[model samples]
Target chain A: MAEMVFQRTKGLQDRPFHYCPGCTHGIIHRLVAEVLEELGVLDKAIGVAPVGCSVFAYDYFNCDMQEAAHGRAPAVATGIKRVHPDKVVFTYQGDGDLASIGTAEIVHAAMRGEKITTIFVNNAIYGMTGGQMAPTTLVGQKATTSPFGRDKNHAGSPIRMSEMLATLEGPAYIERVTVTTPAHIRKAKKAIRKAFEAQIEGKGFTMIEVLSTCPTNWGMSPVEALRWLEENMIPYYPLGVYKASEEVK
Target chain B: MAKVLMKGNEAIGAAAIKAGCKFFFGYPITPQSELPEYMAREMPKAGATFLQAESEVAAINMVYGAAGAGARVMTSSSSPGISLKQEGISYIAGAELPCVIVNIIRGGPGLGGIQPAQSDYFQATKGGGHGDYKMVVLAPASVQELTDLLMEGFDIADQYRNPVMIIGDGMLGQMMEPVELREPKKRNLPPKDWATTGTGGRGHTNVINSLFIDPAECEKHNLKLKAKFDEMEKNEKKYEIYNCDNPDIIVAAYGTTSRIVKTAIDKCKDEGINVGLIRPISLWPFPYEVFEEYADRAKAFLSVEMSLGQMVEDVKLGVNGKKPVYFYGRTGGMVPVPDDIVAEIKKILGGAK
Candidate 1:
């Protein structure tokens, strides 16, 4: 008899993903799902899906979910977590949903030290909206909205969200990770697991900013997208533990 | 509890807590700030959660979250603040979530004044948010009525799986009146089986969402929502006919304006002028049946409001050209006096009395 070495996590539904070819969202979603299943909280978890590319995440997560309006997931999660403190609540958001239109919600959620986990997928471009320039869009990167290759003077430099959020006193854990290789995938999963564990332990806000790739929007092949993200995004984002409180450890 | 003198805003907080509301998310806005302050002080004692959100936009979204989680929740704001909440309200309505919203109306087109006004009548009754939806709007005439409406508002929302708006003027929110926080009569509320409460191994995931990518699916959802609204129009229309017994002239008013109209009707009675009032408590359903019933007997319909003739349109629609419709109003934070309403009533009567 052949032994099965790997299986899909029960935290995720069996539905096929709608993400574009070479998009890193699938890997990130799988990592989050695997962490939830490993943490043994799949049945008690509620995920808030954002209005960007992952708007359909509700159909992908096996647990109960809510689809929030544009830029309102943090506030929505805050509401859920405040009422059901024992339930595991997390928000999966994109760069435009988190760093741009929803800036105030994310900042204030951290300011309140809300006991919720956030999976911030920083793809540096808007995917669902047909590749518009995002707040995390790197300097000199071309987007449909920024046709002039993201002029530094006209559009501000990319926002380093994890580093910025780590400065706030509310967060117990904050990290920046990527999934460009098998080794990186394992590390990203570890970061996601730690964030969820911190949330379950009643720590303050925990967030893992996943530096992802959008191959279709970036006008690159999937392999080239990974190389581009490694050379461009990783240099600016710097994959590491930005902040981790002693209590979280 | 026995009847106690309470401020209108504080009474709302007490009534909501008594109604088993588990959460409140609000922002400080004039004429409605006291309610949030009261909740902030009282919610913890009742084992409920109260949060002062960064903005009205955030507060309403928070209400959406709690409501989707199958928790009774609410938010409150005045006119301008309510404007900020319209986006979230539209989403909540589209998603068919149960929550209560209180709007202590002040003057507005933009940042008008802190004084009481009925300018938001159209915004409340009409869809302020960008969507084809309806909210069961209750326009309470006094502090006691405000208390009563909120006590039952949560149940009304849950029963229909829709948002409920309790609207009052700044005067109604600030005035002190004797109110008994009565235990609401039991209602047959539908179970919140659709709430996103972690499934608990329920064999299927319950998603709280309003996004329908397919146009056909979206249309179907819209029709389903319309059916619920039609049910509300049929079953939830509430109004009080005062001195409407074979009246010579009829007056239509709601919320704080209705109280002034009532006083005007009494003054008209002293002069041997038979005047009647059709006070609509449910503003969205508009109590059109009462207007239709009184149209043949009443010579004219006077729509009294604090704004420049908003509800008059609804009155005209209800009267259906059978009786001449006239509007009397004060604007920009001005409250109408009984004498002014009386004068308008006499003017519309054409000195026949």
Candidate 2:
């Protein structure tokens, strides 16, 4: 029998995820769990799942998990981290949850310099709700609500959370990364680990925005979706650390 | 460890911090604005989280989020603001999350007034949120009680995995008194094993939610909540009976009004009027039996309140029509003084003769 070499990452259950094929949420989830395993912070960490496509993240992450109201994961993580300062607390939020309803919460948490990490998955469309225009939807991007593509005259400009948050002096780290390909996935993992490390170091407010793919919403095949992210999303949401403490160097 | 003069609202806030509460979310409102203010400055120094939400709705939702994450979270607002929080409160109740909500009640039918009032008696006791739910409501008549109740509220909330309400009025929130801050006992909370802390090989992941789609499942959940409430009513009902021996009249009140009544009863005693007071500490599981015993002997009972006539109904129910239950109150931002209560008690007692 051929030895099974590549399997789903540990800490994530064998159960098939609910994400559509080519959906990058699975990749991001695996990356988070992998980082937690590598850091050996799984038992000492808590994760808040947002109210979006990944609402069932509690089912995927092997660690203690909580489901927050739409857009309120940051607030919840703040609560958890404050109560259990010794434990690592992080929020896994989607574009809709983080950029729209939860805007104030995430912004204030960052502004207050809360000692928590936030994993922001930005696919630029409302996936679970079926392709609605997200706050981060690029200009001229086609979505269900933006059938004519996002009109700059109509819809406001896409929000760059990493850059916006970096402007605040409170955040110890802020970075945007993509998971469209293997090399980018590795970089994304490094950014994610840096965020968790910031928290472990008692640094305040670290967020990593993962530029993701929602093939189902974008109406593209998985491979094509990855290419689309590289060509279109990258220029709009450049992948790099917008802010990090010099001490981390 | 030492006595300090503190406003009731500030004392409650200070007590919560001392009790290890590290998360606070609130929107400013009259009568209770000092609570969030106190937390804002103190939480940071304590290495806690504090946020002034955009609206009362958002504030309570934030509290819901924090509580679900197994934090000792709290929120405070007056009547109108508390009404806005009903939606999130219902969710917190349904999720069985531990939290504390302080209601410094003001007069209200709608934006009623920014004065002290006990009008929210029914709302606090009957669960201010939708669905079948009950919060352990603690009414504090004095600054000491307010501080003690804040600590007790946290304990009760964690013990039952449910939200508890520290129900005070504007008077209690604003009054200043000497209070000895007691050292908080270490909490006996189980490790937030069920919290969203990363599972780390925990047997199974936990979900905190209020949505039960199936009617039967919803019923079962509600019934569980009801059972917890029943157990609380039996085990946690608390009240204070003052000068009940050979009293011809018993006064029923709570919170600041009860304190006023205490003084009025003293005045009544000076005038040879035999009056006593039964102050409900646990306003929801009211001291109904105690009031009944007093009603059994007293010829008349008076409910002196700051609201039009909210708690008087409870007093009537407790009295069970055995005696004449009179109500005298000042509403719409007006607070009835001790003299007003004494006058009413004198009239009721004179009529009984």
Position A14, candidate 1: lDDT: 92
Q: Pick the candidate with the highest DockQ.
A: 1
Q: What digit string (tens of lDDT, one per residue) describes model 1 on residues B1-353? A: 67899999999999999999989999998988899999999999999989999999899999988999999999999999999999999999999999999999998789999998989988988999998999999999988888888988898899999999999877888899999987667889989999988878698898999999999999999999999999999988889889988788999989888888888889998998889899989999888877887999889999988999999999999999888888999998998999998888888787544
Candidate 1 Cα misplacement greater than 4 A, ranges: B351-353
For model 2 the local lDDT of residue A184 reads 87
For candidate 1, the per-residue lDDT at B98 reads 94
Q: Tens digit of lDDT per residue, candidate 2, span B145-234?
A: 899888988988888888889888877888899998786456566665566655546666667777665799999999999998887789
Q: Could you tell me how far off, in angstroms, the CA of residue B307 lies in candidate 1 after the best superposition?
A: 0.7
Clashing residue pairs, candidate 1?
Answer: none
Task: Give the lDDT of residue B265 in candidate 2.
Answer: 83
> In every candidate, what fraction of the native interface contacts is reproduced?
0.82, 0.59
